[model samples]
Target: MTPEEITRTSTTYNLQSWSKQKGLNPIPVKGGEGIYFWDHSGKKYADMSSQLVNLNLGHGNRAIIDAIKDQAEKYCYISPSYGSEPRAELAKMLVELMPDNIGKVFFTNAGADANENAIKMARMYTGRYKVFSRYRSYHGSTFGAGNLTGEPRRYPLEPGIPGFVKFFDPYIYREPIEFASEEAASAYYVAKLREQVCYEGSDKVAAIVMETITGSNGIIIPPKGYLEGVRKICDDYGIMMICDEVMAGFGRTGKMFGFQNWNIKPDLVSFAKGVTCGYVQLGGVAVSKKIAAFFDDNVLSCGLTYSGHPLACAAGIACVKYYTEHKVLDNVNKVGKTLGEILEAMKKKHECVGDVRYIGLFAAVELVKNRKTKEPLVPYGKDPDGVMKGLVGKLAQKGFMTYSHENMILVAPPLIITEEQLREEMKKLDEVLGEVKA
Candidate 1:
């Protein structure tokens, strides 16, 4: 179909997530290669958001493509009851990649299901009813995972499943109370969290779920010692620690996993996006050896028909090998530093840039109406002024594709992005933000 036909058919018959259907002008992407994708009109744009921050290896990776093809030719569908070479190989690879304590894997189609299963596993393993997650998080959109989410997206799914509790994130930049240092800020937040845990009854808590280095609702990196404090709290309360690494995993955060940035080990880890670099749908929860052993005697009580599908697993295995063989993590660390430097410079140059938080290739630039008051350019969940919307539109017009959430702009290109391409695309971002008024 032609680009116009595609757009018309989609707009008429399809419903979009997080947006009104009327007047929506969705981009008709025909093909993509590396860090660039072109529309049907042949207009090219750099994929700064990594197409929802999932395409870590970038578009059209031959290794992953060949793996999928090879798997399909051999055999595609197999029930979860049966053993499959690709599934076993991918699971083994994941166990090796994850923390030493996390020795088993349970596959799912994507992050939402991974999170849902993770929650279930936590509740069952601990025999506790409540779970805690931060206020500025997006776990997934499924029933259980959506309720675990702490942002406005959860509002529409209101009066959701019971036993999900909310907690405040340690956003130092926007902290209401002043602290002399990050250490102090970390202490304060951790102390308050401990109190909340006490009030909520520690023995009744199942787990503490968090996006290690929060994604989507601003890349709010936790303060130093903050994650360690939470880990200690979980240990003290016999509560499981769960890290949702869907967006921050697979070299997006310089490290292979976001939690690796700190000295801690979560009992359960939920990951999806970069497992196959969005080549095919594959996500899973990695459980500690202790939890895995519990299932050896008792039933897991969770299953998916598509769990560990051969094609997806084959793609995952290939993606993991590619990352290791090509040293993609090294590239992320090297180029990520340069990207951070460029963004830091932009923060100094642009008045609209209230704050810039970045680690590796994952980043967000917060826009503000006033730096003095730190007023957000677009208030949370309400961009009625359209300032942030217009800014993103201008960037797209300039052939630099990115997306904004609330008052922040995300700049997470593929992990394969080079220093030269990084500088070029970021220059475009700086130019676009430089044009915006304070």
Candidate 2:
């Protein structure tokens, strides 16, 4: 199709074709494979956002396509309440891949529902009403999950479901305890969290939820021992630990889950995005056996119609098989090292870059108006309607795609992206950053 045809279709059906922005639009993708897509205009753009940070396996994997087709032909849309072969098999495999004591899976068609369900599970397990999440974190967009979110994106969703409380993030660059030792910073934040819990009445707190590495929030990698400290606090307070691994799981972090980097285990790990590598829609809550057993004796009171859809199960099974056989996790680790070095070099060259953080294949560059003062390039989402909106466009015009949110740029390409490809993309990004100003 021509650009005019694509634009016409977009205009007729998608009134807000670009995520609620007045003039924003998207390229009409004809097809995708590996890490790039060709638009209706016959222009190719690297899918740097992984199409909402899914597509961990890239696109057009024959194995996933075949599995999806085969499953649809055999059986499709069997109610999730009924257990089918694919669903049962997928559950078994998921448990095997997860950490010890996490043996139950609750499926969903998307990330928001997964988190919402996970939150419900946490509350049910603890029989407490309050949840604690961070200011820089995003759980999901649904009312329940949005309330659990920390950023301004959740503002519209408020007054959010009651009992969810927010806290400051452990951003070392814009550190709350600046000039302090890393160990001291961790201890201080832990103490502050403890105080917050007490202020809220720890007994009334159901869970302490967090994005393992705070995705879409500048990739804030907390100081070491931070998660372990949280774990200990939860253990002491009898609060359930819920980690939203929606954007940080399934080989995206080289390990199976982002929390694994700290070697800390959460009571519930809500996941989506990379599970089926965006081959088919799938998301779910991976619960500890203790929490799973709670529902065994009592009603869980949470489920969705399309939970564990057969096609999604088939796709998930195939996706995991591909990751194991092709060693995608290993590739992420290998390429992650290279990407890490490149990003550090970028920070050195670009003073506007306040911080660089990465884990496995996931990475982000935080932009600042003044590096010494650590002032954000602009307030989040209040872009002031100028070249700020074109930062991403500038990268795109240079034949690369990157995701910009707030004042940070997500450099997360597909896990399958190579060092050479990353270098090329980074070069384009550097050129664009040089031209951008606060």
Candidate 3:
């Protein structure tokens, strides 16, 4: 459908920031319930990517909707400086839910703001100016947050801030070596970081930020022992350890936080999206007691007008209740395993499917020009041919919906997704792949 043909007022303004070469279709979504959303055209499609990989809980969650509505009716926006019941309740609730020792919380409107605040906190607490992040990672799009982003997406907004250093992340599929085992690859990455710290001076660095499981650039899962090694390294150097769980948090990996898989503790963890199952805008950094102490009458130079908004907190409280009461996380574990097996089985059959990296419900099917070489199907967002370019569009046309980015497709659905529904999406994907089955 042409953009001019459809005219309707959206509750919120839409951002026109997309690759003009590849025009945005801008379909108008009318209703969403469960994993499927119906566009204004009266057609329903799966939210396989969960709307920017947020919405860890699917749509039409009446419980969350009711909580938001109820909270809005009772009390809406309040200044961040003041105390609110839902705000305090969510803060305590999140602290309990996080790993012990992570006893502090600073809320934000989304992941970007959370990261910005975390950086500020780290710099303040450590009294250092430098922060490290791995290439092929995205923290957010805000000036400070986007500067911390290591991926090419950050290129447009360069010279972001001083002390922003980018480094390499361990990607096994495209390892620097001819070939290396997972253990060897991980060790190599650790050594690289160690060398970097020596050159950059760990004393000058405030924190080493990285995604537990790399999200947007590619679903690159760190090799076993990788995160633990980093945690130890950070401990040794007195550098604050930070994990960007913006994508991996909230049962996306079948655990409350993706870092749990590695069994390592971080000084601070930034989270959003799944905390409220995308019911409302909410994000925050789970700070340790050490950082929290800095807030004691220090005139903490960080806050948002909508920080800890009551409505978002209400959504978060209800979403957490849903996860705890209904075993949504357990469902993620079961469905995640089931999904992995099917995907691996498909990997063997499809040559374009080079690598299948997953952690629970969070999964990525890396598309490649050749399975042996593992060449990317497209360069970041530039896909000229319709083979890989039209995959999501084709899936939509086939009565299913998913997301594709930079030669990989994120198959993350809501944690509440059922095995039966999952298979249906997979089945549709199988058919869609046939059309571009290179």
Candidate 4:
């Protein structure tokens, strides 16, 4: 179909997520290759946010495409009860890729359900009810995962599930306290968390869930000893540590998983996005040996119709192979360093840039009306004037596609992106930032 026809059909017949239905003129993507995708009108866009930070291997990956095709030719569907070759292989690959403590996998269709199953497993295994997650985090939007979420997006799920609890992140930039060092800040936050757990009755808390690097909510990297402190707290009590790696897994952070960057071993790790690089939807929870052993006699209550789907597993296997074969982590480290440098420079050059936080290719550029006071470009939980939207639109006009959350702009590009391509794409961001009025 022509671009106009495609847009018309989609706008008329389809419902877009997180948006009003009317006046929707969505782009008609014809094709994509490497770090770029083009519309039907031949306007190419650099996928700066990696299309919601999931397209890690980037567009038109032949290996992933061919793997999906191969699986389709053999067989497309298989019940999870029956063992399938691709499913078994991918599960083994995932186990091997995860930390030593992680011993088994429970597959799901996407991150939301992966998290949902993880929560159930945590509750069952610990025989406790309450689950704690930070206020700045985004797990997913499904009912359970939405409650697991702590941001404004979770408001629709109000009067939420009883056991889900919220806490503050170590968002030092916005924090009122002036700490002597990161260690001091970590101590303060960790102490507060432990105290909160005590007040809530630690024995009743099933798990302490956290995004290893806090994606979408400003990429708020934890200060030194914060994760270790959390780990210790989880150990002190029998509470499980669940790291949501949906947005930070698979070499996005120049490590296999985001938790690895902090050298912490979470009891349950929920992952998706990069495993299949959006080639096919797949997500899973990697449970530690202890959690796996818990289900030896007790019944594992979680089930999904599409769990361990063979085609998605096939795509996952090829995607994992491509990561190692192509030295994707090496590229992430190399280009990510360049990205950090560019973001730092932009922070210095742009008056609106209040802070720039990054790890590997994952990064956020926060906008503020006043750098001294750090007044956000838009108010918290309210973007009534569409200020952030307008700024993102400016970036889009320059062919640099990314999304904004509140006052921050996410800058995550595909893991396979080259340094030259990164520099070029980031130049567009630099230009757009230059245009923004403080």
lDDT of 4 by residue, 301-389 (tens): 99989999988999999999999999999999999999999999998999999999999999999999999999999999889988888
Looking at model 2, residue 2 earns an lDDT score of 77
| Model 2 lDDT, residue 151, Cα | 88
- The weakest ten consecutive residues by lDDT in model 1 span 426-435
Q: Candidate 4 versus the native: TM-score? A: 0.99
Alpha-carbon local distance difference test for all models: 0.93, 0.85, 0.84, 0.93
Tell me the TM-score of each prediction against the true structure.
0.99, 0.96, 0.95, 0.99
For candidate 1, give the lDDT of residue 155.
91
Question: Local error of candidate 1 at 132, Å?
Answer: 0.4
RMSD of each: 0.8, 1.6, 2.4, 0.8
**lDDT by residue for model 1 (1-438), tens:** 999999999999999998978899899889999999999889999999999899999999999999999999999999999999999999999999988999899999999999999989999999998999989999999888999999999998999777789999999889879998888998999999999999999999999999998899999998899999999999999999999999999999988999999999999999999999888999999999999998898888999999999999999999999989999999999998998898889989999999999999999999999999999998878989788889899999888888999999999999999999988888788888878889
